[model samples]
Target: MKKKDKSHSHSHLAFDHVSFSYKHSDKFTSVFDNINLTIHEKEFVTILGPSGAGKSTFFRLASGLEQPESGHIRLRDKEERHRLGKIGYMPQQDLLLPWRTVLENGLLPLEIKGMNKKEAREKVLHHMKKFGLLGTEDHYPHQLSGGMRQRVSFLRAILGGNEILLLDEPFSALDSMTRYMMQEWLLEQWHEWDKTIIFITHDVEEAIFLSDRVLMLTHPPIKGEIDEVNVPISRPRNEEHRSDAAFMKLKQDLLKKMRSKERSL
Candidate 1:
């Protein structure tokens, strides 16, 4: 189940025969079994699954926050198994420090890397404008909208300076209108940053709208190959695409496939 690609550009992230589990008491809860996949540079990939399907577990493994029981999680810049800071990660919650201002929070990653505070502030300020957080730099998380907090969280991940990002339902908590706006803004940022991103979400429409391809965790304790659906619609997509025939068809198909295990949970 191991995948090897020598191509310098497309093969930016590789999950080689990765198997993982969580130990609970005397029993081991199986999460993944021999998972193999490759995420290309600048590609946006979303993961979808029913509740309790281990979507977050995969993210933990990808982010190097937890180790797989077996197999390799390799990045383009390295060959060994150590990953750690090679990829930036954002969790479901904004996880912004309420005590810190937006700009200061975004600069946490840089500071952890021993970067100078003044220098990091300058860099964060420059990107804050692009993220639409320019005038709100001094505002705390509690003072901003939900969408604004997420933008700050994303800014923190970006400041980590990894070409790959792991996001776990980063926008699921916002209201419908705010979620839509965040999605549009995130897509714009993705296009501009040219970074590879792997996202986890339960929302079918969000997965389809945001990803170049969607991976469905069809089988739990899933082994070997998994279901992957490519978005046929072109990029720079707008709200109109949701009404397009191709989009609806793909949506229906993916929904059907993903719902197969819904009743089990």
Candidate 2:
């Protein structure tokens, strides 16, 4: 008998030949066919594609918000298998409650999980300080700048002690300068937490800047899988790197892939 390989035996998370089509529809259009992918522990993977490439759908599947029509999603977290609460999702909008103070908002998930108020407050405040929202704990969402609100949302996403983060265009709403600063801040925070992150973005530059591996999708509902592009850029990336030849080359290559894929359709 042959010995089994652990990597081949199972994955941290896997979409095995997964296919999804909307329910209760005559068209029964297929989003993807035989889609297979996996994310290992603490790997930073960015899903990049044009609108409607099933990028959002992928996140939904990974986070257990939606199930596959066919095939299976095997998340190897035996402790909390297929549990939605195990994943942290930050949607496109900050979605902060206007009435709740920033601290309360960050502590909501912890409270729901039955953590004591004092413990939740301590954890939320620790993240707030780590992620640069320390002084805004009492402020309402409307009182903060766009960047600050995003920081709060990020804190909330991680507060529940979720190991995997599903980021759906979290920084798309910011101005250019603010977006860049937030990106840097996010990179620093990810370092401190060491969580698995699957970030969805149509912006190739943003994807490349933050991701260790960028997964490019093809068009249509569920038509294509990711074209994994490794970003060789060093950590603590800055404004200066955007002008570097290597960065530009990777950017241009991503554009080319996008254009070629688009033209194919």
Candidate 3:
């Protein structure tokens, strides 16, 4: 995250009584009713739940990929169905162009936005160095490790110039060690960029370790619901934080919520 001046102030992002369901669905829906949440400026929030808890649906609503049946989404002073381009989205897969080099992949978003090659390369180099992908800029995606490829994907997302990031299980595919390393890098970048991030994960531990707050969702089509757990650990959280009492307590609470859903089903 880029450092801002001492006096810089920004409005917190919010979801105000938002509700949604698929367009052709009947009463059976993916999500609906008063789903309210708020993320303070530069805050890191995690959305956690078992599969089918409507996590993806909620993200779609937040990303303006889908519209809510009713209610408003307020970002600062703006409202009224805005497609927030300021948000960077990274889905489960990296979604890199196979033929593109690391640098080219990082600059993909800029290219699509009509930036010239020179301008795009400048932004790409900036993120490459910031993200520790400097020497591999000329390598192809397949030539990099899983973790590095994900890094390139993240660089591309950041190059989109979105301050708020919506990440949906972005590191889930990697091995445990790689996943841990990626999580560390993610927090480092989050601190450096100072961007507001909303990350979705099924991993309770990851949620506790990475977020200022964890929103635990109920089962499918969750509505008017949340178990908002605050993580009070200090910044730049690491493996040690995982064994702390607060971390265990939050993890247990989240597990209980997930187990409840399992039983109900």
Indicate the residue-level lDDT of 254 in model 1: 90
CA lDDT of each prediction against the hidden true structure: 0.83, 0.79, 0.78
Give one digit per residue, the lDDT tens place, for model 1 in 148-170: 88778988988998888898888
RMSD of 3: 3.6
Q: Which has the higher TM-score value, candidate number 1 or candidate number 2?
A: 1
- CA RMSD of all predictions: 4.5, 5.1, 3.6
Location of the lowest summed lDDT over 10 successive residues in candidate 1: 1-10
Candidate 3 per-residue lDDT, tens place, 98-140, comes to 8989987887789878999998888789878866789998898
Best candidate (score: TM-score): 1
Off by over 4 Å in 2: 1-10, 24-29, 77-81, 129-148
Q: Which sequence of candidate numbers ranks them by lDDT, best first?
A: 1, 2, 3
Model 3 residue 21 CA deviation in Å:
1.0
**Candidate 1: TM-score?**
0.86
Q: Using Cα atoms with residue i matched to residue i, what is each candidate's TM-score against the true structure?
A: 0.86, 0.84, 0.83
Error of 3 at 117 (Å): 3.2
Q: Compare candidates 1 and 3 on lDDT and give the better one.
A: 1
Q: Which order, best to worst by TM-score?
A: 1, 2, 3
